[model samples]
Target: GGPAKGEGQATGGCPVYSHPAQLTDNRNCVLCMTCLKACPHRSVEFNLRPPGIELWTTHQPMGHEVALLFLLWGAVLVHRLPEIAERLQLPQLLARFDYHALATVVLLAAPGGVAWGLYQLNRLGNPCLQGRPFVQVAYGWLPMVLLSSLAHYLTLGLTEAGRIIPVTLATFGLATAGPIWVAHPAVIAFLQAVSLLLGALLSILLIQRIAQQPWLRLLPLHGMTVGMTVCLYQLIV
Candidate 1:
């Protein structure tokens, strides 16, 4: 017979009804791949698509999920905090506190604080949005957040990933030439910049689509997104 039924829906071991779009809902998925393995007909298939498309399309994030996004954003900031602090001439201030403790605070607070402040400005500028949940509009930042994280890590991937070749060869006591094909610093920087630019553009478009308000009213949110992109570009590149 076919797959067993649970309340009339196929019991495919998916908590979210095996809905492709809902799979993009990160909070509900543990990435276990049980649905794929459990499907008797091998009908489940994973396809690649544009990154962050679900943010503007079908992902309806809740308040806690929005908080999780900010947490991830804060992690990006924490990863670059040393450079940021030095650039801001806060090295002395940073010295007084334990590095791990400070990073903990930044990881917990920075993004959420900035997001909350921007949310207030958004509400003030767009009075019509006062009744809407902040989480609803905050989804607009999803693209920027995801792309910025990717760009931040791109540096390590481009510069360090090539070392695995030599490292793997040396691990077996074999002679090695060197890193196979590391990207030039300039090229890596350029790619990082391009990634941030794309993220900023997508973020602005998403904000406009989500808000559906006058351009003037949307300026604060747009400014926030652009400002973050600029800050991340400076830190990462």
Candidate 2:
């Protein structure tokens, strides 16, 4: 077949391999299933491969899948923010404490969520293939996990701010930050914990839905029921 101009010809610093007239162009291979079945590492597959043939070295194949999974479930963490704000009356109470720190913490936690999700993906064999090595999953999730654990500390800050400020009636006095401190301080301490709990439950439920597993429906429902119970307890106390 005659080569069309600017088509088959290699251009722009293309390397020329002197061996068997194999086009030597990365783009030339057709994914004909030959190379994949032949690969010893079993890293190649039709789902991920282009229509023709190609070779990937050190293909962290699981990276992106894991990323996607984590991201999908992680969306739940943000989803509940509005409800949380409303349930806790965050907007009205915003003036009671140091929002600067709370906002900063939230900003920090958002990125942390993304990082942990990436890490979890890596741990699960990079289920989404984000290109980071599988071994680094711990380091990836470390920040979010630690920060999540400390979420309750945010309430402590609020309470501390209230205590330091001498304004009494003009404020809820020091009690403004009191809600966070006493309002199920354990739960408030780790907002991301709820995020994770719900996020994980959501991920599992989604998988169950796709597979139509009868048991999957209970996971989210159970989580919701438990969360509601906690909310009730917080309110009563």
For candidate 2, the 10 contiguous residues with the lowest summed lDDT are 51-60
Candidate 2 scores a C-alpha RMSD against the true structure in Å of 18.3
lDDT of 1 by residue, 1-237 (tens): 125522233444666545544555565677766555555554666689976566657777688878888888888888887887788777754676676576668666776787778778777765655434567778878888888999999978987797888888888989666657689999989988998999889878887777666677778778888888888888999
Task: Kindly give the stretch of ten consecutive residues in candidate 1 with the minimal lDDT sum.
Answer: 1-10
Off by over 4 Å in 1: 1-58, 93-100, 125-131, 176-179
Per-residue lDDT tens digits for candidate 2, residues 41-144, read: 43443355542122122222345544553343233334344455667677743444566346445643553354455445433652433333332221223223
Q: State the C-alpha lDDT per candidate.
A: 0.75, 0.39
Winning model by TM-score: 1
- Model 2 scores what on Cα lDDT? 0.39
Q: Candidate 2: where is the Cα deviation over 4 Å?
A: 1-80, 92-104, 107-237
